[model samples]
Target: MARVAYTTPEGRARRDQLVRAAMQAFAQRGYHGVTMDTIAAEVGVTRQGLLHHFPSKVDLLVAVLERRDEDDSELLSTLRAREDTPLAEILRAVLRHNAQRPGLAALFTILSAESVDPEHPAHDWFADRYRRGRILVAEWIAAEQARGRITSAATPQRLATSVLALLDGLQLQQQLEDEPLDIDGVLAELLALLR
Candidate 1:
Protein backbone atom coordinates (compact mmCIF):
# COMPACT_ATOMS: atom_id res chain seq x y z
CA MET A 1 0.00 0.00 0.00
CA ALA A 2 1.25 3.47 -0.82
CA ARG A 3 1.54 5.65 2.26
CA VAL A 4 -0.45 8.86 2.23
CA ALA A 5 1.01 12.12 3.47
CA TYR A 6 -0.61 13.14 6.72
CA THR A 7 0.59 16.72 6.42
CA THR A 8 -2.71 18.52 6.58
CA PRO A 9 -4.66 19.00 9.81
CA GLU A 10 -7.48 16.68 8.73
CA GLY A 11 -5.05 14.07 7.49
CA ARG A 12 -3.12 14.17 10.76
CA ALA A 13 -6.34 13.92 12.71
CA ARG A 14 -7.43 10.93 10.67
CA ARG A 15 -4.09 9.25 11.23
CA ASP A 16 -4.33 9.84 14.96
CA GLN A 17 -7.84 8.40 15.00
CA LEU A 18 -6.66 5.25 13.25
CA VAL A 19 -3.76 4.85 15.65
CA ARG A 20 -6.04 5.17 18.68
CA ALA A 21 -8.43 2.63 17.26
CA ALA A 22 -5.59 0.24 16.52
CA MET A 23 -4.16 0.66 20.01
CA GLN A 24 -7.44 -0.25 21.68
CA ALA A 25 -8.03 -3.16 19.32
CA PHE A 26 -4.51 -4.46 19.84
CA ALA A 27 -4.98 -4.10 23.58
CA GLN A 28 -8.29 -5.99 23.65
CA ARG A 29 -6.96 -8.64 21.30
CA GLY A 30 -3.33 -9.59 21.11
CA TYR A 31 -1.44 -8.04 18.21
CA HIS A 32 -1.72 -11.30 16.30
CA GLY A 33 -5.43 -11.43 17.02
CA VAL A 34 -6.28 -7.97 15.72
CA THR A 35 -6.78 -7.38 12.04
CA MET A 36 -6.27 -4.16 10.07
CA ASP A 37 -9.86 -4.49 8.89
CA THR A 38 -11.04 -4.46 12.51
CA ILE A 39 -9.14 -1.26 13.21
CA ALA A 40 -10.42 0.35 10.02
CA ALA A 41 -13.99 -0.59 10.94
CA GLU A 42 -13.55 0.82 14.44
CA VAL A 43 -12.31 4.08 13.02
CA GLY A 44 -15.07 4.16 10.40
CA VAL A 45 -12.56 3.90 7.58
CA THR A 46 -12.09 1.43 4.78
CA ARG A 47 -9.13 -0.96 4.82
CA GLN A 48 -7.56 1.01 1.99
CA GLY A 49 -8.09 4.24 3.91
CA LEU A 50 -6.37 2.78 6.96
CA LEU A 51 -3.62 1.44 4.75
CA HIS A 52 -3.08 4.90 3.32
CA HIS A 53 -2.03 6.04 6.77
CA PHE A 54 -0.41 2.74 7.78
CA PRO A 55 0.98 0.51 5.09
CA SER A 56 0.57 -2.68 7.11
CA LYS A 57 -0.55 -4.02 10.45
CA VAL A 58 3.01 -3.86 11.68
CA ASP A 59 3.28 -0.27 10.58
CA LEU A 60 0.10 0.56 12.50
CA LEU A 61 1.48 -1.29 15.53
CA VAL A 62 4.67 0.73 15.37
CA ALA A 63 2.65 3.94 15.28
CA VAL A 64 0.65 2.77 18.29
CA LEU A 65 3.79 1.92 20.26
CA GLU A 66 5.52 5.09 19.21
CA ARG A 67 2.56 7.18 20.28
CA ARG A 68 2.67 5.54 23.71
CA ASP A 69 6.40 6.06 24.07
CA GLU A 70 6.15 9.65 22.93
CA ASP A 71 3.65 10.45 25.65
CA ASP A 72 5.77 8.68 28.29
CA SER A 73 8.99 10.31 27.15
CA GLU A 74 7.35 13.70 27.36
CA LEU A 75 6.14 13.04 30.88
CA LEU A 76 9.51 11.68 31.99
CA SER A 77 11.31 14.64 30.50
CA THR A 78 9.03 17.03 32.32
CA LEU A 79 9.37 15.26 35.66
CA ARG A 80 13.12 14.76 35.32
CA ALA A 81 13.59 18.43 34.57
CA ARG A 82 12.60 19.29 38.12
CA GLU A 83 15.84 19.30 40.09
CA ASP A 84 14.14 18.39 43.39
CA THR A 85 12.24 15.41 41.99
CA PRO A 86 13.65 12.01 42.89
CA LEU A 87 13.70 9.01 40.61
CA ALA A 88 11.21 7.14 42.75
CA GLU A 89 8.74 9.99 42.70
CA ILE A 90 9.13 10.33 38.96
CA LEU A 91 8.46 6.64 38.52
CA ARG A 92 5.53 6.71 40.88
CA ALA A 93 4.01 9.50 38.86
CA VAL A 94 4.46 7.46 35.71
CA LEU A 95 2.78 4.47 37.32
CA ARG A 96 -0.08 6.62 38.44
CA HIS A 97 -0.46 7.91 34.92
CA ASN A 98 -0.49 4.39 33.54
CA ALA A 99 -3.06 3.35 36.09
CA GLN A 100 -5.37 6.00 34.76
CA ARG A 101 -5.11 4.49 31.26
CA PRO A 102 -5.71 0.80 31.84
CA GLY A 103 -5.97 0.01 28.16
CA LEU A 104 -2.49 1.35 27.45
CA ALA A 105 -1.15 -0.51 30.45
CA ALA A 106 -2.82 -3.71 29.28
CA LEU A 107 -1.42 -3.14 25.82
CA PHE A 108 2.09 -2.94 27.18
CA THR A 109 1.67 -5.90 29.51
CA ILE A 110 0.15 -8.10 26.80
CA LEU A 111 2.54 -7.09 24.03
CA SER A 112 5.65 -7.34 26.18
CA ALA A 113 4.77 -10.91 27.08
CA GLU A 114 3.74 -11.93 23.59
CA SER A 115 6.79 -10.34 22.03
CA VAL A 116 9.14 -12.66 23.92
CA ASP A 117 9.26 -15.04 20.96
CA PRO A 118 11.93 -14.03 18.46
CA GLU A 119 9.55 -14.63 15.58
CA HIS A 120 6.97 -12.15 16.91
CA PRO A 121 6.77 -8.89 15.02
CA ALA A 122 7.35 -6.84 18.16
CA HIS A 123 10.09 -9.01 19.59
CA ASP A 124 12.92 -6.75 18.53
CA TRP A 125 11.00 -3.66 19.55
CA PHE A 126 10.43 -4.91 23.07
CA ALA A 127 14.02 -6.09 23.36
CA ASP A 128 15.38 -2.74 22.28
CA ARG A 129 12.89 -0.87 24.47
CA TYR A 130 14.07 -2.76 27.56
CA ARG A 131 17.72 -2.28 26.72
CA ARG A 132 17.29 1.44 26.18
CA GLY A 133 15.01 1.83 29.19
CA ARG A 134 17.55 0.05 31.41
CA ILE A 135 20.35 2.28 30.17
CA LEU A 136 18.34 5.48 30.59
CA VAL A 137 17.21 4.47 34.07
CA ALA A 138 20.72 3.43 35.03
CA GLU A 139 21.98 6.85 34.10
CA TRP A 140 19.33 8.44 36.28
CA ILE A 141 20.27 6.21 39.23
CA ALA A 142 23.99 6.93 38.79
CA ALA A 143 23.28 10.61 38.76
CA GLU A 144 21.19 10.34 41.91
CA GLN A 145 23.93 8.37 43.63
CA ALA A 146 26.44 11.03 42.70
CA ARG A 147 24.15 13.59 44.24
CA GLY A 148 23.89 11.47 47.42
CA ARG A 149 20.13 11.07 46.93
CA ILE A 150 20.19 7.27 46.66
CA THR A 151 22.34 4.51 48.09
CA SER A 152 25.47 3.55 46.23
CA ALA A 153 25.62 0.09 47.80
CA ALA A 154 24.52 -1.47 44.51
CA THR A 155 25.62 -0.72 40.99
CA PRO A 156 23.33 1.59 39.05
CA GLN A 157 22.76 -1.08 36.40
CA ARG A 158 21.47 -3.59 38.96
CA LEU A 159 19.23 -1.03 40.60
CA ALA A 160 17.90 0.08 37.25
CA THR A 161 17.08 -3.50 36.31
CA SER A 162 15.31 -4.05 39.62
CA VAL A 163 13.32 -0.86 39.26
CA LEU A 164 12.12 -1.78 35.77
CA ALA A 165 11.33 -5.31 36.90
CA LEU A 166 9.33 -4.04 39.86
CA LEU A 167 7.35 -1.67 37.66
CA ASP A 168 6.56 -4.37 35.10
CA GLY A 169 5.59 -6.87 37.79
CA LEU A 170 3.39 -4.36 39.56
CA GLN A 171 1.59 -3.49 36.32
CA LEU A 172 0.85 -7.17 35.61
CA GLN A 173 -0.35 -7.70 39.14
CA GLN A 174 -2.53 -4.63 38.92
CA GLN A 175 -4.24 -6.14 35.93
CA LEU A 176 -4.98 -9.39 37.77
CA GLU A 177 -6.02 -8.17 41.19
CA ASP A 178 -9.73 -7.91 42.00
CA GLU A 179 -8.91 -4.85 44.05
CA PRO A 180 -6.78 -2.13 42.58
CA LEU A 181 -3.16 -2.32 43.67
CA ASP A 182 -1.70 0.60 45.56
CA ILE A 183 0.84 1.26 42.90
CA ASP A 184 1.89 4.61 44.28
CA GLY A 185 2.28 3.40 47.85
CA VAL A 186 4.05 0.23 46.74
CA LEU A 187 6.59 2.13 44.69
CA ALA A 188 7.19 4.64 47.42
CA GLU A 189 7.83 2.00 50.09
CA LEU A 190 10.00 -0.24 47.94
CA LEU A 191 11.87 2.62 46.33
CA ALA A 192 12.57 4.24 49.68
CA LEU A 193 15.06 1.47 50.40
CA LEU A 194 17.33 3.00 47.80
CA ARG A 195 17.32 6.39 49.46
Candidate 2:
Protein backbone atom coordinates (compact mmCIF):
# COMPACT_ATOMS: atom_id res chain seq x y z
CA MET A 1 0.00 0.00 0.00
CA ALA A 2 1.72 3.13 -1.13
CA ARG A 3 0.81 6.47 0.34
CA VAL A 4 -1.37 8.71 -1.73
CA ALA A 5 0.43 11.93 -2.47
CA TYR A 6 -1.19 14.97 -4.08
CA THR A 7 -0.64 16.04 -7.70
CA THR A 8 1.38 19.19 -7.01
CA PRO A 9 5.07 19.24 -7.91
CA GLU A 10 6.06 18.24 -4.42
CA GLY A 11 3.16 15.88 -4.32
CA ARG A 12 4.10 14.38 -7.66
CA ALA A 13 7.57 13.82 -6.34
CA ARG A 14 6.10 12.13 -3.30
CA ARG A 15 3.73 10.17 -5.49
CA ASP A 16 6.63 9.11 -7.65
CA GLN A 17 8.36 7.82 -4.56
CA LEU A 18 5.28 5.87 -3.65
CA VAL A 19 4.91 4.55 -7.19
CA ARG A 20 8.48 3.32 -7.30
CA ALA A 21 8.08 1.64 -3.95
CA ALA A 22 4.84 0.01 -5.01
CA MET A 23 6.37 -1.10 -8.26
CA GLN A 24 9.11 -2.87 -6.38
CA ALA A 25 6.59 -4.53 -4.13
CA PHE A 26 4.45 -5.59 -7.02
CA ALA A 27 7.39 -6.80 -9.05
CA GLN A 28 9.44 -8.55 -6.42
CA ARG A 29 6.38 -9.79 -4.58
CA GLY A 30 3.82 -10.09 -7.37
CA TYR A 31 0.41 -8.40 -7.45
CA HIS A 32 -1.32 -10.40 -4.71
CA GLY A 33 1.71 -10.32 -2.47
CA VAL A 34 1.64 -6.56 -1.98
CA THR A 35 -0.53 -4.82 0.57
CA MET A 36 -1.33 -1.16 1.00
CA ASP A 37 0.30 -1.24 4.41
CA THR A 38 3.47 -2.71 2.94
CA ILE A 39 3.54 -0.12 0.18
CA ALA A 40 2.83 2.71 2.63
CA ALA A 41 5.54 1.44 4.92
CA GLU A 42 7.93 1.27 2.00
CA VAL A 43 7.16 4.92 1.36
CA GLY A 44 7.02 5.82 5.04
CA VAL A 45 3.39 6.83 5.08
CA THR A 46 0.15 5.80 6.78
CA ARG A 47 -2.36 3.66 4.89
CA GLN A 48 -4.87 6.47 5.00
CA GLY A 49 -2.30 8.78 3.51
CA LEU A 50 -1.68 6.30 0.69
CA LEU A 51 -5.38 5.80 0.17
CA HIS A 52 -5.82 9.51 -0.28
CA HIS A 53 -4.22 9.31 -3.69
CA PHE A 54 -4.98 5.71 -4.70
CA PRO A 55 -7.98 4.14 -3.03
CA SER A 56 -7.19 0.54 -3.99
CA LYS A 57 -4.36 -1.78 -4.91
CA VAL A 58 -5.79 -2.17 -8.41
CA ASP A 59 -5.74 1.58 -8.89
CA LEU A 60 -2.14 1.77 -7.71
CA LEU A 61 -1.14 -1.04 -10.07
CA VAL A 62 -2.76 0.76 -12.99
CA ALA A 63 -1.00 4.00 -12.12
CA VAL A 64 2.38 2.31 -11.84
CA LEU A 65 1.98 0.63 -15.24
CA GLU A 66 0.67 3.81 -16.88
CA ARG A 67 3.49 5.96 -15.58
CA ARG A 68 6.01 3.33 -16.56
CA ASP A 69 4.65 3.37 -20.11
CA GLU A 70 4.81 7.16 -20.27
CA ASP A 71 8.36 7.22 -18.99
CA ASP A 72 9.47 4.56 -21.48
CA SER A 73 7.82 6.43 -24.37
CA GLU A 74 9.72 9.57 -23.43
CA LEU A 75 12.98 7.66 -23.14
CA LEU A 76 12.47 6.01 -26.53
CA SER A 77 11.84 9.39 -28.16
CA THR A 78 14.94 10.72 -26.47
CA LEU A 79 16.96 7.83 -27.87
CA ARG A 80 15.49 8.40 -31.33
CA ALA A 81 16.47 12.05 -31.09
CA ARG A 82 20.03 11.22 -30.04
CA GLU A 83 20.65 8.94 -33.04
CA ASP A 84 18.28 8.41 -35.91
CA THR A 85 20.73 6.45 -38.07
CA PRO A 86 21.98 2.92 -37.68
CA LEU A 87 18.82 0.94 -37.01
CA ALA A 88 20.85 -1.46 -34.86
CA GLU A 89 21.80 1.38 -32.56
CA ILE A 90 18.16 2.36 -32.14
CA LEU A 91 17.15 -1.24 -31.34
CA ARG A 92 20.02 -1.60 -28.90
CA ALA A 93 19.00 1.56 -27.14
CA VAL A 94 15.47 0.26 -26.67
CA LEU A 95 16.70 -3.11 -25.41
CA ARG A 96 19.04 -1.47 -22.92
CA HIS A 97 16.20 0.70 -21.73
CA ASN A 98 14.01 -2.35 -21.09
CA ALA A 99 16.79 -4.10 -19.16
CA GLN A 100 17.08 -1.09 -16.90
CA ARG A 101 13.43 -1.28 -15.91
CA PRO A 102 13.19 -4.37 -13.72
CA GLY A 103 9.77 -3.48 -12.41
CA LEU A 104 8.29 -3.02 -15.84
CA ALA A 105 9.37 -6.56 -16.68
CA ALA A 106 7.34 -7.93 -13.81
CA LEU A 107 4.33 -5.80 -14.66
CA PHE A 108 4.56 -6.97 -18.25
CA THR A 109 4.80 -10.59 -17.20
CA ILE A 110 1.59 -10.38 -15.21
CA LEU A 111 -0.13 -8.37 -17.88
CA SER A 112 0.81 -10.86 -20.57
CA ALA A 113 -0.67 -13.76 -18.63
CA GLU A 114 -3.83 -11.84 -17.81
CA SER A 115 -4.30 -10.21 -21.16
CA VAL A 116 -4.93 -13.48 -22.95
CA ASP A 117 -8.29 -13.78 -21.19
CA PRO A 118 -10.12 -10.77 -22.73
CA GLU A 119 -11.82 -10.19 -19.39
CA HIS A 120 -8.78 -8.68 -17.77
CA PRO A 121 -8.77 -4.95 -17.33
CA ALA A 122 -5.31 -4.72 -18.86
CA HIS A 123 -6.33 -6.63 -21.99
CA ASP A 124 -7.33 -3.59 -23.97
CA TRP A 125 -4.29 -1.64 -22.88
CA PHE A 126 -1.87 -4.33 -23.98
CA ALA A 127 -3.74 -4.91 -27.24
CA ASP A 128 -3.81 -1.25 -28.18
CA ARG A 129 -0.26 -0.73 -26.97
CA TYR A 130 1.11 -3.46 -29.24
CA ARG A 131 -0.83 -2.09 -32.19
CA ARG A 132 0.63 1.37 -31.64
CA GLY A 133 4.12 0.04 -31.15
CA ARG A 134 3.91 -2.04 -34.31
CA ILE A 135 2.77 0.98 -36.32
CA LEU A 136 5.64 3.09 -35.05
CA VAL A 137 8.20 0.40 -35.62
CA ALA A 138 6.84 -0.20 -39.12
CA GLU A 139 7.20 3.48 -39.91
CA TRP A 140 10.77 3.39 -38.66
CA ILE A 141 11.53 0.32 -40.74
CA ALA A 142 10.05 2.00 -43.80
CA ALA A 143 12.25 5.01 -43.20
CA GLU A 144 15.34 2.85 -42.96
CA GLN A 145 14.30 1.07 -46.14
CA ALA A 146 13.86 4.43 -47.85
CA ARG A 147 17.33 5.47 -46.72
CA GLY A 148 18.77 2.30 -48.32
CA ARG A 149 20.42 1.29 -45.09
CA ILE A 150 18.19 -1.74 -44.76
CA THR A 151 17.52 -4.25 -47.52
CA SER A 152 14.19 -3.48 -49.13
CA ALA A 153 12.97 -7.07 -49.26
CA ALA A 154 10.40 -7.67 -46.51
CA THR A 155 7.57 -5.28 -46.08
CA PRO A 156 7.89 -2.80 -43.25
CA GLN A 157 4.83 -4.22 -41.53
CA ARG A 158 6.27 -7.72 -41.32
CA LEU A 159 9.63 -6.48 -40.03
CA ALA A 160 7.96 -4.28 -37.47
CA THR A 161 5.82 -7.13 -36.13
CA SER A 162 8.86 -9.35 -35.84
CA VAL A 163 10.79 -6.69 -33.95
CA LEU A 164 7.95 -6.07 -31.54
CA ALA A 165 7.56 -9.81 -30.98
CA LEU A 166 11.21 -10.07 -30.10
CA LEU A 167 10.93 -7.30 -27.54
CA ASP A 168 7.87 -8.79 -25.85
CA GLY A 169 9.27 -12.30 -25.82
CA LEU A 170 12.64 -11.12 -24.53
CA GLN A 171 11.03 -9.25 -21.69
CA LEU A 172 8.85 -12.25 -20.92
CA GLN A 173 11.91 -14.42 -20.56
CA GLN A 174 13.68 -11.86 -18.40
CA GLN A 175 10.85 -11.80 -15.89
CA LEU A 176 11.40 -15.42 -14.98
CA GLU A 177 13.01 -15.99 -11.59
CA ASP A 178 16.10 -18.17 -11.28
CA GLU A 179 16.36 -18.45 -15.03
CA PRO A 180 19.43 -17.60 -17.07
CA LEU A 181 18.38 -15.07 -19.71
CA ASP A 182 20.93 -13.48 -22.01
CA ILE A 183 18.90 -10.56 -23.26
CA ASP A 184 21.93 -8.68 -24.58
CA GLY A 185 23.15 -11.63 -26.57
CA VAL A 186 19.66 -12.22 -27.84
CA LEU A 187 19.35 -8.57 -28.86
CA ALA A 188 22.68 -8.71 -30.66
CA GLU A 189 21.57 -11.74 -32.64
CA LEU A 190 18.28 -10.09 -33.42
CA LEU A 191 20.04 -6.93 -34.51
CA ALA A 192 22.05 -9.00 -36.98
CA LEU A 193 18.77 -10.44 -38.25
CA LEU A 194 17.05 -7.05 -38.42
CA ARG A 195 17.88 -6.57 -42.08
Highest-lDDT candidate: 1
Model 2, range 76-193, lDDT digits (tens) per residue? 7786786456766677777777677766767667766667778765678788888988898888888888877677987889888988888778777766646758777877776667
Residue 59 alpha-carbon offset, candidate 2, angstroms: 2.4
**lDDT value, residue 58 of candidate 1:** 86
Clashing pairs in 2: 1-35, 1-36, 1-39, 1-40, 3-50, 4-50
lDDT of 1 by residue, 1-195 (tens): 355765799999999899888888888888999988889999999888887888898888888878888987888778877867788877877787888898999999989999998998889989999999899889989888988989889799999999999999988998999897788888888777778
Summed backbone clashes in each candidate are: 0, 6
Choose the strongest candidate by TM-score.
1
Q: Which stretches of candidate 2 lie over 4 Å from their true place?
A: 1-13, 174-182
To one decimal, what is the Cα RMSD in angstroms of model 2 from the true structure? Answer: 3.6
Model 1 misplacement above 4 A = none
